[model samples]
Target: MLMDAFVDILRTIIWPLAIVWVSYIFRNELRGLLNRLSLFKYKDLEAKFEKELLEVEKEAKEAEKLLDRSLPHIADNEQEKIEQLLRIAGISPRAAIMEAWREVECALNDVAKQEGIRVKGLVGNSLSADKLAQIRGIPRENTDIYTRLKYLRNQAAHVPDYVIEEREARRYVQLAIHLAGVFRLKPNE
Candidate 1:
């Protein structure tokens, strides 16, 4: 009777123990697989982000063309800064995008300062692109594009695990440069 009881107990516990042992043995591999799956799952989100960026880029190009007059040349120093950001994109795309957006913010802050708007600190206050646009009499379409760029920047900033491709980062930096140029224009220009 004891022998039969022991056999029954072994059968009940054996499969569960084997599964636990196997899981422990391949834990690191399983973790890596799950991480890859997480990235794959977010691929749709990445695609949508890229599509929005492309639309904003197109809008920025159209707006630039509509200006008719040439944009004021971006200074050599500014060009160097942009190039540095592009190089950074190769190492860390998220950091490059964030820095590019900071360039846009700095340009907006400069405009705000030009208009006698108080800028509080080094990084400056939270003066938005739309507010600066309205104050500077920028066209509504251009303002919309700037707002969308800010929106994309916010997404990149907030989503910790969001992956930005280097090319996408480059596109974002280019669009930011264009918008910053527009904001730097004289109020009547």
Candidate 2:
């Protein structure tokens, strides 16, 4: 009775699974046969799949660009905090603004180091020249954060008239947030 039951169980489960396996092994042939029966055209179906795949790729690229544009906004809170500190220190409005630019530059250089990015003509407190090949995956960018930061540091010793654009500020904020991820930071906490 036990052997009979085992065989019955095999008949119900194993046989079906074996048939499924065989069908799957010949799935392409079966699909071609079905297509030839005028049920559907494989070429049209394949083209539809390909078109959908291309659309998906296009959407992914757009999303990546949007994310890139959004990244620079991550440093806003930090900029606010730093500005408040400068204000509390009794610095002039212009001086406080320049200090904010310095923070951004510092953040960018620091982030580059964290990501192992190599930058050229890296004057002042910027990412060093030895970091390029390791992080070629990172895009080459020229943000005001880098230029203004270096400029501010240069002019900081003399006149405090360094100016940073609003766009640069936003970009640096995004960079700070991106770098934070590499270092395993949990946002502003």
Candidate 3:
């Protein structure tokens, strides 16, 4: 008797959820049916669903744009890349700093390669800033900047609540440019 009661309770809960899921999946069909029968009664429901759908699409597009803009522009000639990062900084300092740090990491990696420094990471992968600094044998001051950049990048990437100031972002962009110059890598036009 207990087993039967439990089964009946499960069925009661499951059927509604299953119906709602199917209705959601076949919303188009439901809309058409509603249109054909008792049209006035369901008009409000249809309008509400359509409004929610439009909002979801708008949010998806904005998310796509943000992701595209946040990627580091390493291939852009150095000046252009810095400009792009600065522009992003104007809107989102965290994205700007993270992008600038990526450029710095790429510059450091290139220098390591040109100098024949063996990074500890696997082949074809860039080394972490600290590991790259060790391989390059940079001075203590340089090491400090590299470590700081690494910290900022980590926070920006992993912490949703992390914030960066515009001034700090600009400083990081300049530092990345300076470091690239030190490596003698010309930013391509």
Best by lDDT: 1
Full-model lDDT for every candidate:
0.80, 0.43, 0.56
- TM-scores for all candidates: the values are 0.72, 0.31, 0.45
Q: Write the per-residue lDDT of candidate 2 for residues 23-71, one digit (tens) a residue.
A: 9999999887765564244345335434433443354344345333333
lDDT, candidate 3, equals 0.56
Candidate 2 local distance difference test against the native: 0.43
- Per residue, candidate 3 scores C-alpha lDDT tens digits across 25-82 of 9999999887556534434533443343344335434433432123234455766877
Q: Which stretches of candidate 2 lie over 4 Å from their true place?
A: 1-69, 72-79, 82-91, 116-139, 143-145, 160-189
Best by TM-score: 1
